[model samples]
Target: MSEALLIAVLALPAVGAAAAFFPDRAGRLFGTVLAALAFVASLLLGAYSQPASWFAYTPAAQGAPPIVPWTSVDTPWVPALDLRLHFGVDGVSYPLVVLTTLLTLLCCLYTLWHVPTGGRGSTLVALLLVVEVGMLGTFLALDLVLFFVFFEVVLLPMYAVIAGWGGERRRHAARKFALYTLFGSVLLLVGVFTVVAAAGTADLVTLTSGSVSLTRNTQLAAFALLAIAFAVKSPLWPLHTWLPDAHTQAPTVGSVLLAGVLLKMGTYGLIRVAVGVAPEGARWASPLLGALAVAAILVGCLVCLAQTELKRLIAYSSVGHMGFVLLGVATLTATGIQAALIGNVAHGIITGLLFFLAGAVKDRFHTGDLAVLGGLRERSPWLSGLLAFAAIASLGLPGLAGFWGEAFAVVAAFERGGAGWVTLGVLAAIGGALTAAYFLRMLRKVTHGAASPAVAAPPLPALRVSGMELVAWSPLVVLALLVGLVPAVVLGLSAAPVQSLVEAVTP
Candidate 1:
């Protein structure tokens, strides 16, 4: 039943993508239903029974495999390459899989009511479904080559979404996004073959289990290739130039998915593949990685401070937010990995809501410039309130979804205990302050003042919230509160798997 659920999760979306071209409203409704079903299937993937104490913090027994998928399906795919149709999920990946499905459903539902210009609604929905399949497959894939295949699958469909249904600069943004990630994909392909060639197999479970011996030099090289590849997707520091442009020009749903689950592929790969498959390299590079993550945090916050455009500012914030997640992974401890996991889920929820609000603001005002927007509180109280809530939550307010990952990331770094790690922790804490400052600034500029010319302009549609918007945004709001109040929602499931991974990588 679990295996069937896995297959259903992937298959439903693929079929939906195909069915979405069936023309008009029928196709759009069909796609939305399939997306909803896919989300349900993903939820069920975690429903299988386990030992009563499976969530306990006890270490794995000696000689046990670091990763044990709760449900998996494996079959031969390419004999010559030793590849197979291997896919599985454990506590570590289940939350992300569910996140991908949920957000895709929301995006699909959003499309049903409001399709962006330059494309049919059905086509946009189709592209979203395709992206969902790639993301789900990437998370569930247990074979290295298969993982790479799924990773690359997301690139083109997302590119099409941006190019076909995005803003004025969409083509440029789409091209830049494509070129940047495709470069990463090239490196990713090389990294996959590097490990497969050296290890003589493509199974992630085997490679991560320490059954295959890789020398330090090989590990270092493979880790470099894989880390850089994932970094571009993570858009770490210097490699992140493409993201703001992509987000600035992408349509609402595009930005939401791009921020929501797409960036996660990189961080997830960093934890599950690069670090898991090459621990020696992760250790060797920890200081450098930690330093770069700090750089991203500070730089992203600084940039956000200077930004006038709403979406662009939010886009830059992701750099800092993801920096926290990467910092957790760089610590290479159970607390750190678990922090990173929750961070991934938290960022997806909060940022997805932010984009939804930003899109609505842009849609109504026909502008995203902070200079031209104000008095949201008076003009549209609910929208302003939701925006304030999302922004505060994003700034890492205590007792919200955003706090756990950033706070725990700092805690994990401190726990690592070297001078450099301590320094990274301290600087990251400062970045947290900078985060608050920029968000407050954004709120003051966009939501606090008297109505701007744009806001007060005549002939504008009523500021009243639409039912569709309420339906779409409510889940995110609830999730931000829910996950914040009960972090165990993500951390509980991830604790055991994270402990196992840390143990595997610990020298």
Candidate 2:
């Protein structure tokens, strides 16, 4: 385990994306096979890779640590500006990297089974592989400039996926999504430069692992820039307007990955970049962040109650679920950060399942409007049951993956109360209750009652759940239950890393 494994993990997908330009049949096969290969390579990297420095300039001061060496590939690219081509994974980012690969693999499988209308399967699969590379790179990049490059790499492919292969208003949604995220990327770039300039280095590990420090003003300014950038990506509260449109218009695979992996990048950035590099700033701004988190929770639930479209409803639900994760970050404590990490993974699994089910329902009944769809249980009990199960999981039902993150977040807030965090905790609890209310409302409207004319219309084939759908969704379902029953699976991985983060803030 050297850099060979990490290089293979990234290169295989890039190669796959390029190969997907072949003839349609061959391209699709190559895409899926290559994505599977990349996923395996990532797993191997997780298991066998050791801390190694691919390239680094020795520091002037004796006994100082190099730019990279902690399960990373580090190579000098711009010594004058202190930039490096660096990639690494620690406990905090490892699970997310794995989740990205897993979800991309599943999306490829789903694409093979049911290619979305209005696009070539090969193109969609190729774009998905590219997105995987960007996501994995974001999670693993150990230098701020390198991280920003990977972060921006995801933008174009996702925009094309939406605009080229989406529903009505696709272009508008794609443009909005692109513009919003691009604006954030600008802020992120500026913030990265500000931090690098202030700290005299661009290595994320060096700055964040507490080797560098900045003045209070620099910390505050940089964190402000970075937080706004991350917030737009997180789509917190008012800034979150782009998410519903994007999710509603995007194709099934697009929606799944958007909700599953893309959104986590924002919250993860808050933890890794904003707090990790600007601890004092994080403490200074924690109150405002906490308030916004509560606002997102409440606002999302209220919107979910009013949403008629299934995908739109699920999209709004993400805002609320992510609020818990953000609140955990705002708490800036180990327990809270662990909750944030678990919540991030749980949201990926549970919301990915919800989006898949929503897509399946839309495909069958040809409508996602709650008023026009009902009695799915009578015709497609399995699909209906899965939808119900996903809804329960989303509602934070006990013994499911969604439960622990939300519960722990509230507990952390209550324990770490100050400057209205207690109020934030109470409001979050209400959001959780509202989460149940709207989910139950959705189930009642779409899963129960008399079959509306659309559902009962004659000549409609009784659509059974497809094998590919099961293959894509079953892992999420099982993982949700597994994590719920034994949260240590996720929490255990992030605990040590999050504790380190907590110390950064506390010290």
Candidate 3:
């Protein structure tokens, strides 16, 4: 109800990270205390938000109320460039802020005993809280420069996690991750500057309300720069080469955030920036974006099929899932945008769950190679069952989170047509089949056989799956069912934003 929520949301973790630096094992205790309070505050904010504008596609009463009053905080920061430090959220930002906080807190829980016992554990937890602050700020920022600053803040901690605490090729993977992302950030800065210079203001609320259009040539160029930046984060094909290595090297909590909230930043930016500000450019670039989307789906699926490593396979599959989100955006319709929006949330939860479980399995077995791990069902029925369930959901099994986004995107594609859209849709459908093939194969290989030697973990007093693990996984499983059964839980709140975006971009 007040800006205090925003300040507290960002500050709680910073306080925890600072407190963790004490000479004792206070990092874990500080993280727990602060994480719990931050999560609770976020929840209270969600429950206390005001009502939003209505969308006819959804019943008026169904959407989530604003997570706080639709309040904007602004003060002169870089007055030389007419930039102000501004931040606010409407319906769109509400859910994602809650998501970032929710997952950060959950990731904190998962790390309590789950982090690598001896090596850089405190630093990992502290960095994670910093990552949370960055994600929260990115979603809530109302100024382009502010958004960019917060967005970049996320890079350091993530790079450190992968490079410092990752697997065998941590340095190489971290360097590649930094290079690819830094390039994108450069382009993103160029685009942000272009918008500020051309439009005379960088406040998102004002920019959305202002009907200023860049020249078609300018629009196309700027959109290309901006879109590519987002795509790299989205890890859309070609630009996605760095993701597998990064994911493979990252710790479990790192992978969860990467697959979950971090990747969504790109797709979110494309809709919020490119289409929202440069509708003409979006229309002109539709065919190109569509082609890239379908291509990414096919290429990602193929990679998934060929991967022998479990984490690498899951990372590739994200490339495929995100392709579906991009494909939806290319259609430039309410349904398409809605599909992208809701699908992003679904993919985040389900895939985040998979990575979390994958890390658990790897900890138990000391490996993530499919050929080495097997019959997890026999060894740990609970873990095996959850893995199978997540795999099914990933493959778009009905009555689950995965089905809504893919199905809706396919429908959106079917409903729209222009410049080879038909072909794009056809290829995407085939990609969908490939998705099924890879996930099914993964299930067969990892959970179906007798417990293999690779699955044998260190003989440290049989690590019982603790109550805390249940506390972490139970929400994911319930959320999978909740969203699967009642997707309106998300789709409803997102409808207004989706419609607003489509109307802005439509011819």
Error of 1 at 99 (Å): 0.4
Please report how far candidate 1 places residue 310 from its true position, in Å. Answer: 0.2
Candidate no. 3 TM-score: 0.94
lDDT agreement with native, every candidate:
0.92, 0.87, 0.81
Which candidate should be chosen as best, given TM-score against the real structure?
1
What digit string (tens of lDDT, one per residue) describes model 2 on residues 1-507? 747888888889899997557887678888999999988987788667523231222222333322233377888888776678888876678789889988999998898888887778898899999999999888888888988999999999999999998999999999999999999999999999899888988888789867787999999999999999999998787799999999999999999999999999999999998998999999999888888898999999999999988899999999998889999999988778889999999999999999999999888878899999998877778999999999999899999999988998998899896748888999999999999999999999887977778877634454787787899899999998998898876765555567567766885
Q: Across residues 1-507, which tens digit of lDDT does each residue of candidate 1 receive?
A: 888999999999999997556886778899999999999988777776243343445555666776888889999898876679998998888889989999999998898778888978888899999999999999999999899999999999999999998999999999999999999999999989899999998899999998899999989999999999999998789799999999999999999999999999999999999999999999999999999999999999999999999999999999999999999999998888888999999999999999999999998889999999999888888999999999999999988999999999999999999888999999999999999999999999999979998988734356778899898899999999999998887887777678778888899
Estimate the Cα RMSD of every predicted model relative to the unseen true structure.
Answer: 1.4, 4.4, 3.1
| Candidate 1 clash pair list | none
After superposition, the stretches of candidate 3 with alpha carbons farther than 4 Å from their true spots are 51-69, 456-464
Q: What would the per-residue lDDT of candidate 3 be over residues 39-79, giving only the tens digit for each residue?
A: 77766665555444323244323232212225557789877
What pairs collide in candidate 3?
49-66
lDDT of model 1 at position 265: 97
Pairwise lDDT winner, candidates 1 and 3: 1
Name model 2 segments beyond 4 Å from true.
50-70, 458-462
Q: How does candidate 2 fare on TM-score?
A: 0.95
List the candidates' TM-scores in order.
0.98, 0.95, 0.94
